[model samples]
Target: MDADTADIATIGHRIRHFRTRTGLTLEQVSDGVGLSQSQLSMIENGKREPKLTVLQSIASAIGVDLATLLVAEPPDERTAYELELGRAQASPLYTALGLPVVRPTKGTPTPTLAALVGLHRELARQASKAIATPEEARRANTELREWMRARDNYLPDIEDLAEEHVKASGHVSGALTHREVSVMAKHLGFELVYVNDLPKSTRSITDLENGRIYLPPASIPGGHGLRSMALQALAHRVLGHERPESYAEFLRQRMQINYFAACCLMPRSAAVSFLQEAKKDRDLAVEDFRDAFGVTHETASLRLTNLITVHLGMRMHFLRVGEDGALYKGYENDGLPLPTDVTGAIEGQLVCKKWSARDAFTQTNRTTELYQYTDTPAGTYWCATQTGRGDDGGFTVTIGVPFADAKWFRGRETTARAVSTCPDPTCCRSADASLETEWADRAWPSARLHAHILSPLPTGAFPGVDDAELYSFLAEHSGPLGE
Candidate 1:
């Protein structure tokens, strides 16, 4: 069968599998689906093609996302939708929802994208009407959850496909040059008209039957560099007889292509192997790994998280400083269980603090305690840091794992400031006296503080560490590392 037909067949099989698993009779399923039994049978048999809406309904009935049904096997054509889904799957949103965000699959309709768009529209309408009722809010939240789930699943696939296509056809081949192609087209009686001053917003190139070119605003450049790139892109398309119609479409395709490239760059087997080696070496530094893999720092960091969380079955979280100097990008729980935006030294300022106090901090297998303060509007955070880096890069990639238990901080009521009472304390030092003066100056309310404290683990009890050698050492020496 052709590629598209094979996709349809795989989808049909999945639908049938879900239906069978649910133990619904053909008549019962058809009745629930509002389709004739014969029609349902034909769909299940791949003898008939179902409309997108019908397919969605069938998937919903089976308690699976529509995209899940559509993505039966990886598509041969490698479209934008596939790439977007792949990238979206890598997002923390997908992890939070407990869904398979990233997996190989053929071309499919993005249920997540459709859901997000629909939710956005609904939210806009509700906002315009000033939805005041609790019922409305609850319903909105439900729809939002569904949209989030779909977006978490589909957007990555779209990105992957687009990136792949752009890389494949946008660039001139090894022997061919843009000038040569332009000259060749002219020789074939086609006009070699170059639009150098196209708008910077141009996105895609389209070929009219009359031989006129239509380029989206986003794809065009504000100056010569972009103009050259656009011309080259257009020239490549002219030679290939293919081009995306809009900038958004072009971006969507580009992202898809990028997703595929990332996958190809970090194939599952290779990624797994790298994770095993990293685990063996106990190296968690993203920058060092990026150098080894020839990937960007950001990609390396994300891949490291994925390796530990997905492949190694370890709980990991990523924290990054936002442009606004706020806390963001919290994932998996590297022991800080608090919300991402919660203001504190440990929340957004961990890395900077580590960088500043790098000399004082010692790398040891034993748990070490460290304390730092958060600036006013938010109080100080006294937390312990667990420092470990892989030996490969001479400690270039450092993983400063933090531990904060709410109970421990709450126990130190006299020392700790509530988030509401002093949202941001200017100085955490007891000698500063400003915080004490401020406390005495204002009417201190009986405020509740959210605290996170790290629980100490037994020495030499690392989860991923091999126990056989450690046990053998203990049996022979009758003592631990401290002894």
Candidate 2:
């Protein structure tokens, strides 16, 4: 059957149902509709599709409306069972076994049909469980992203929690200070302890029994990350999180702690006020937001995604694409077309070479932020991007909104622009036709595997965190602060 029309088998069952319910036999309805009994029987058996006019006449002959025969659902439990049996027989799962197809008649038992469908469902479930580790991670990320998108990526409860913690720390200022972080830790009955040899697999570890949060003495540029790390460690206790049972739960806890830390670093009320004032003046910029919060540009950009659409009514997207144009992280409520896989994950997918996230890496002047307007299949979008280098390499932090909302942003007037028909091979992904014509027959380049490509997935409740190492570090440090 054509996809546009109802499945012929189900339709046939419905017609049979209405015909029998109206006390009409095949011969009687066939004669009334000007068709032979054999032809009508073929139609009833789903061996042939009747013309629309023929179906109409049959409906009229059977004392029913034409619409009654067009529904997709099987008319009865028996009909549903018959349909599933047929589908299973036609499936590769049964056929590949070289077993005879089971054909049932009116004499077939419903219990047998129920057992077959149940077996098929279990087989499919087991098949899906064979997904690889990377695929599982991608699925987890995709689910979490959709969850965030549904709530506009804003959790008022988490926001309120962070706000309460910040207030309890007596914070009224520019950036959340290290001292304030210690105070916040203490308020939760934990003290911050600086350490030279924290566990390599962990960022900050909370000694729940000892009531001490162990952190590294070193900090990121301009002293930004320590407070967030401290708050994240404290958050595990405050949020009452247990060991995650699955990758999805682990991802949820990670995002919650990250969001809590971000809100602590940049309290929502003050951040919203600052954004509103900037938007009012049409001077909203990521650099200024980063400076105001004294946080990294990436943190400010991500935090903006949590606050902007809900508070200022502006939809935007955030990206952390690497120097090689592969997207490392992405979030969007705006209609920017990102390259996504079947899992709906944008991470590890390459963006268009022309995207600001990729192009900003080529710019010489890293001192100033890069801005550009990109014409995508979704629409035009203007983005402000800042490039920075990390231990892994260089990447860009980009925040963009639709062209209509660009007027309220500081970089709206940038002359730098490009057109991207991405997710299409012809759009920056494929080589020029002439170039491809020349090279396709001649080249056989070996691809370099990315770091994550071949690495074995880390296992445990917390995927990458080494539990034995974490416990040892905590036990060693739990004795005394100086020790």
Candidate 3:
């Protein structure tokens, strides 16, 4: 295409690309820009060029700078090597490797090995005068990759160290809520957006070059208070390294970081050991596990589920109660059967009654039930249980662990034997029914589980730690929790 046609085509591509990336429909964009949908379509198809006023309006409507729509280069004129170099430059992995494009020069000593040289040295040289010679660059790339691998491998220990540092600085404070942390992140270049009704126990953190943003479970549709607690933990963990980026990329990176964080905090080996120790003591109790591992209750419960489901051979599930007296964070492991196909609670009332009663017991009638109270650094959990066989003959265990009064489990024996039978007659075989409707409802169990679960407690909960200490702890532990 000629220069004029190429410019128009580029503009068209930009408009379409931005619109699709932002998830805006043509009609919606057209209405916002005061243009007919057909007209917008023509412009995007490059059949016609929009007037200056129209271009300005389109840019404004789409929330993009006008220059973004105007920048364009003809495809035919673009150098293939330059494009390849561009791709390499945009990749975080490649950038971290310190590989830059190079241009051959008369007196310049080039690496004899083809793989050691970048595709476009001229572009790289123009881009950065500080780049070293070919040999130096190659060595640097190798060293950088090794460093990155080491960092990724040791992230958990690094995070623990960071957290310790923060604690020692005495900067921790209860008033430093997630919202406040989010606001601080925005000041550092992150734009926090909430995604309502997310599934339970699910969260993500995105690293957008500008900064990082965390999507707490509470922001998800079915999230509970635990979601907030998780976010709080994360805020403390990744305070210093939270960089900002564009919105979409930010969400993507946050998820990647969150997964890494989870893996780091509860490494597969540590989880297995913790579960083995807990099982040996017959103490699936949160307090017992917390003391054994020196973690908060929420961390312990999460670790418990991970252990039972991921590490152990048993299938496991979890639920947390919300303000509406309903269950949230209904999660199940791969080996177990899900009570139902839906993501939320099956029955209307709380699901813990099946195991909460004193006469309730465990069975293998394709289903087993148990009730127990768990304590965490955050609070106490009144949990109910159900286990059933899946279609493939594998077992699925569901536990509805709800936040409740800490006193409820006060007198319950930590080493109590499993009950033999469930006394509730209204219970159903359909796993689809709500816990409240399936069985005879009983009074909330008295508190039996207790411990300082919500520890390194939010700032005000402790006496000596200050904001500096809290920030320092988070920065140190930003990478991972346990090795």
User: Which predicted model would earn the best lDDT?
Assistant: 2
Which candidate order results from sorting by lDDT in descending order?
2, 3, 1
lDDT (10s digit) by residue, model 2, range 1-483: 355556877777788888988888998998899999998888887888998999999889988787878877788898888888788778886786688887777677989888887887786665444333677778888899989988889999999999998999999979989889889988889988878788899888878788888888855455677878888888898789998767678889999999999999999999999999999999998889989989998999999999999999989999998877888899999978888977678878888998988888788898788989999999999999888999889989899999999999887888999999888888887788899898999999987556673354576667678888998887777676664
**Residues 1-483, model 3: lDDT tens digits:** 334333665677678767877889999999998889999988986679889889989888888988777765423222223334444556564475586545423244333323323644644553343323333323333343234333322344434543443343332432223454344445446555443422333344333432444354443333333334344334443544343322223333443344333433344455557666655654555555545544444545555554453344444345443323223333433212223213222222333333332123234342334555543232344454433232333322334333322122223333333221211323422344566575546546665321221122221222223545445433543453232
Q: Compared to the true structure, candidate 1 yields what TM-score?
A: 0.30
The clash tally of candidate 1 reads 72
Q: Which stretches of candidate 1 lie over 4 Å from their true place?
A: 1-261, 322-324, 338-483
Single out the weakest 10-residue window by summed lDDT for candidate 2. Answer: 123-132
Candidate 2 or 1, higher TM-score: 2
Candidate 1 per-residue C-alpha lDDT over 1-483 given as tens digits, one digit per residue, 9 for 90 to 100: 334333555666677767777887788878878999999988975679899889888988877888777764633323233434444554554455575444433244466554544554564554333422333323333343234233331243433432343344333222223344344334333433343333333332323333433333433433222233334434343334234442223333443333344443344445567666765665434445555545554445555544454466554344443322223333333443332222222332323322212312443432332233222222233322222333221111222232222222212222322222222233221335775677767765773322211212121212112346434433543332234
Poorest 10 consecutive residues by lDDT, candidate 3: 450-459
TM-score of model number 3 = 0.28
**Stretches of model 3 off by over 4 angstroms after superposition:** 1-259, 292-294, 323-325, 334-483
